[model samples]
Target: MVTRILSENEQDLRLAGEIIAAGGLVAFPTETVYGLGANALDPDAVRKIYEAKGRPSDNPTIVHIADESALKQLTWRVTPDMQRLARKYWPGPLTMVVPRRDTVPNVTTGNLDTVGVRMPDHVTARALIQAAGCPIAAPSANLSGKPSPTTVEHVIDDMDGRIDAIIRSTPCTIGIESTVIDMTGELPMILRPGFITREDVARTLGKDILVDPTLNEKPEPGVEFRPKAPGMKYKHYAPEADMIIFEGETEAVEAAMDEERAERESLGQKVVVIRYSQEDTETAAHEFFAALREADKDKADIILAAALPQEGIGFSVMNRMLKSAGYNVRKV
Candidate 1:
């Protein structure tokens, strides 16, 4: 069994930092989500991230830093857009993909010349990074292919002995990973969408932020091109149960889900309906599924979600929904 401790003091923070300094893994909270962090510069320490999370070696981890100056340690060739975006969104939920330096291990960048980096706003995470004095390569603090843990409890559920220590915190405020934009490409493009939409990035850059159709998973026929991003490829952010996301008008979609729920009930299987944030202000896209977890706390049969509007940040929200649902879309 794993020993679970709630760390909320200076001494515990120091201890957690020490564990990271010594090249051990630490599951700590970030503004976006909890991340499994290890020394980004050390191959051995970085490899532990692989063994513990069972993450694919090809899947790159983001470098968590305390400040912009930390960027010098791992990368260079920063663009003016990178500077503006960094000044605006650093210390929050934004990841900038930039050209890598020789110091960044191949393990951290997935052998690519570019690396995704961010300065997190979470205090414990920043402290650990400051204490360790190096960018910590981290990904969501769960086994590679599961829903990213947004709470410390979820971290404990997925990682305990697998890491050296856990810096627990409340459920993530952002409740989603950063918007990962690749500047290395010809045009600035959003590789993954979070609270920061492509429009936001475009508006900031004074140029159109080109969006690849690959960002959204279309389950229709005549599909040939491949997505150039990571989050677009796999079944991610999924809980133990199965999930489906409904697409169309809200009322009509809800009606479809009610029927889907009835079908599951008739089949003697539990079902959950995930409506859009527009339906309930209290259940914003960020906390929609997390809120429903209690209703299905006993491990229900499946999760079916109604497609959320692309308006506002709901677009990014739906990306996580459909991805987690594993492209489970049904026509009513």
Candidate 2:
């Protein structure tokens, strides 16, 4: 398929929306990450998203809405807790999983009775959804297990020919997937962490929050586990090169990187080093995926990265990093 690159103009946006309305895939930007989208109400359209990304059906897609009123059509019931979260974090990087209405296809919800939904803050994302006249079920616009695309170029890298069209726009601001919270239970549980920290949600609803245990570490060596949301059951946000992480005091980690770089250079191996200061957690969050893509662009044989402090948004960054490296870490 010849994939067309659509610019962020009225005509282009309309064209992208028309493709979506017609049950074709369109990759567009959101505040969190670029998402490859299809009409959420169309199961066949939603299937194309999985085929395009080679994503497993068990890993569900998040439904993107243009407005809060659209939630009623997708979910069975919207409780007061759901309303508080929507008011606080909608039009931003937060996904709420609630009981799905019969209208929401089992395929879109990964055969579960619940669906994850969110309203993106990006103007073009909202415009495309409104023009399409339907809620869009989308996942990060990258090949399954590869780094999530944050820029139009990155989207083109993994999805240009695979998808119907791409809406070229500004780089994603949050540069990661949204925080996913499950609202089906009385005590809200966070299935994934992102820029919206635990404190942010707790403070908003004035109640304690429960976090999914799988987010911090993998399940037992031989335990059976199934993830309820995307990015949980799969090895995601990885790059082409083999990535290894060095964790320790800042000075020691940097010194180990220097030594490794020298050794690899002597062996005529291309090396990419990604290290960020402890205070640069926000910057790390923004550039982590892009840096992985850069390493791939350089055709690096190996990638060596310094671990982010697992506090604040760094937890999200570390989560992606560990997965990208396949949990290959050495404490220096």
Candidate 3:
């Protein structure tokens, strides 16, 4: 895998931008995580994203920009609440699903009338987008079914000249995907969760954003629930190995992981266990999937993860990990 260390400079940004403009993939950073980017305006370029990630053609990519002006090119309708959220959260870890403009390719919007867009706060990504002169369609810089890469090394390991370049980011600030909300629906709906929460968007809108039931299932067609973004329809951010997690309330999950750990240890099989740790590290939700992904790499046969509290960042990360790992995912 070819890896390039990037400094915040015009030269590297220009190189990455040139690749995007010329219809190639580039991996760059955002506050949330690194993304594999291509020119959003070019369907051919956008198709390369699915090719690189081994992502299904039906699963769309999010359009990322440096500034709010680029949003004008992708979305036809941005509501007042959407504006408020964008003003406060853009250039950060949030993705808004708004009505797609004619310029937005159907592939980029997953054939949905709505499009997913974000203004990444990372200097490297912003500079590259500015130099490229168009919105960049980006998904997590990893294989389609694996965990999202949070570091430059992760991107290089999974996708190296399958892309144009890798911009060495200063480690991901959020260590997960962006919070995705769909304003195109009758009520705002959270398609995916991250650093931004449903409560956070609800507080901004002064009304609760509806949570979709489809989130609990595999990404399949003809499902009864409505979806606005690509992540909603597929499993994502998973590890290479099989991972099973305990669901529901925190204490029950803890006991489940504990019992699984004891049982496996007795069988002499090395196991990786994840439980909520308040003092040892970041919130439980954020670290659980990372642990599972890490465990999968070490050849651990089993991963026991516990569900976190509904409050704060815990809820968002847990939901993503569980979905990515797939359900019927043994209740640890």
Q: Highest TM-score, which number? A: 2
What lDDT is obtained when candidate 1 is compared to the true structure? Answer: 0.77
Candidate 3 lDDT over 231-267, as tens digits, reads 6656666665566767765566777777888998899
The 0-to-1 C-alpha lDDT of every candidate, in the order given, reads 0.77, 0.91, 0.76
How high is each candidate's TM-score? 0.91, 0.97, 0.89
Q: Which stretches of candidate 2 lie over 4 Å from their true place?
A: none
TM-score of 2: 0.97
Scored by lDDT, model 3 comes in at 0.76
lDDT of 3 at 287: 54
Lowest summed lDDT across 10 adjacent residues in model 2 is found at 218-227
Give one digit per residue, the lDDT tens place, for model 2 in 1-332: 99999998999999999999999999999988999999999999999999999998888999999999999999879999999999988889999999999998888989988999999999999999999999999999999999999999999989878989999898998898899999989899989989998889999999999988777585456775556789988888888899889999989999999999999989999999998888888788888999999999999999999998887798989889988998889899
Report model 1's TM-score to 2 decimal places. 0.91
Ranking by lDDT: 2, 1, 3
Candidate 1 local lDDT, 77-110, one digit each (tens) = 8778889998888888888888899889988877
Cα misplacement distance, residue 104 of candidate 3 (Å): 1.5
Candidate 3 Cα misplacement greater than 4 A, ranges = 1-5, 217-227, 247-256, 278-282, 328-332
